[model samples]
Target: MKFSLIFLLLALTSCSKKEAESERTAHSEPAWDASFFSPKTGEILSYRETIESISPQKNLPISPDQIRKRVLKRRQVYDGSELIEGKTLHRYSIYHDGSFTEGFLFHWVNGFLYVVGSFTEDQKITFANPPIPIAHLNMIAGTYWHWPPQAPAGSGSRHIGLEQITVPAGTFDAYKVSIRKNTQGKITLREYWFAPKIGIVKEQNRIYSSGHLRVINTIELSDRSTSDTSDTSEEAPSEST
Candidate 1:
């Protein structure tokens, strides 16, 4: 009886060690290359944006004069790592149209990319109780995932396979993904095309209220530039927004 008890304790210890190792392995192994969507420290991406508003009651598009067009430049700068809500997340400063807009915090765990939170001015972060999963590291055609994990049924993102897309920057093969969300009788659909090394080449966003399209926005990459430490600018149409 004494020997049997010793054996049982040993077995339990062994199982506990195995479980701990498994957890570590899961955290160490990333699903895919994180750089697929995450830009480098000193990379700048310029995009041309066009926005069109539609009248829900009349179901007619707005006048041409009401449509807005502008050039948006986004610069990404490394902001070091921080511990937030018990998770270590990497932060990046986002500059929009040549001014600091916000800090984007990202966490990678179990091969998934999650947006932990965003910080506006002074690095003040507003945490999302549960980090939102933006993409699966190991994405493939038909891959699907939902954000706000507890969101309503029909709210999620899907990979629509790879396709050749053309923008002002030039044509390249890119992965196409579609994201849909439903909230308070309003539905938002966003489609994004990302190139391997280059980030988002194009994005289309449509918002529908009461089953009628209310707004449409399209953004296409106009140019992209990279620098080591200094800011670089690409000449495009005058900036707006």
Candidate 2:
């Protein structure tokens, strides 16, 4: 009888060891796609790539500088009645040197999504105090704001995906983005519409699910500064024969 009891204890010990090994393996291995979260583990992972390296399947080639310019231009306050299901206002703010801040405030309500920056200086703030519009929310969608996966000097790229999309203007490329969390403990998902020549003309973000998107503010290009008059004034006059 004593020998049988010892055998049972040994069997229990073996099972416990196996269970511990399985748990360790689960935590060590990487995820499958890295875009979706692991429901079992509750951990999120995402792929990495630079904004300029992200290429469309069958669209015109766009350079990193061009993409950066387009991102700046799209950052501004927008007033739209159609997209928001009501009147809404979006504010996009960009500094002289290309630093960006985007804020969205709704007219009838109090809720806002503030995108404080990008890969260069990317931050997001969402609050229910004021409502930021949807058009502005779309601009910062996808690759516009880079969080998580940051590099050595607080810079990183976003990995995006494109699904089915249709718009009033025409059929174009639509993209979705998944941000891998940086050391800052932040993550975001976004969607975008890129027109062939105009670049990323529209975007949308579903941030925080509190009925408010921190980055979905609207803007008009007229609200942003796109040129420098100093260079033009310094140009030498050409004497014609």
TM-score for all models, in order of appearance: 0.68, 0.23
Where is model 1 more than 4 Å wrong at Cα? 1-39, 54-61, 68-71, 78-88, 229-241
Which of the numbered candidates is closest to the native, going by highest lDDT? Answer: 1
Clashes of each: 1, 29
Candidate RMSDs in Å, in order, are: 10.8, 22.6
For residue 18, model 2's alpha carbon misses the true position, in angstroms, by 74
> Which candidate leads the pack in TM-score?
1
**Candidate 2 ranges with C-alpha deviation above 4 Å:** 1-164, 180-186, 209-241
C-alpha lDDT of all candidate models, in order: 0.70, 0.31
TM-score of 2: 0.23
lDDT of 2 by residue, 1-241 (tens): 9999999999999999887555433322232322221122111111111122222222344344433212322333222211122222222333322334443332322221223222123324344432212222233334433322234333333434444343322344434343322334333344443322122334544332222222333221121112332122111112210
- Model 1: per-residue lDDT, tens digit, 15-109? 99887555433223222454554555556566777777756664445566654455466555655554554455767777777789888887767
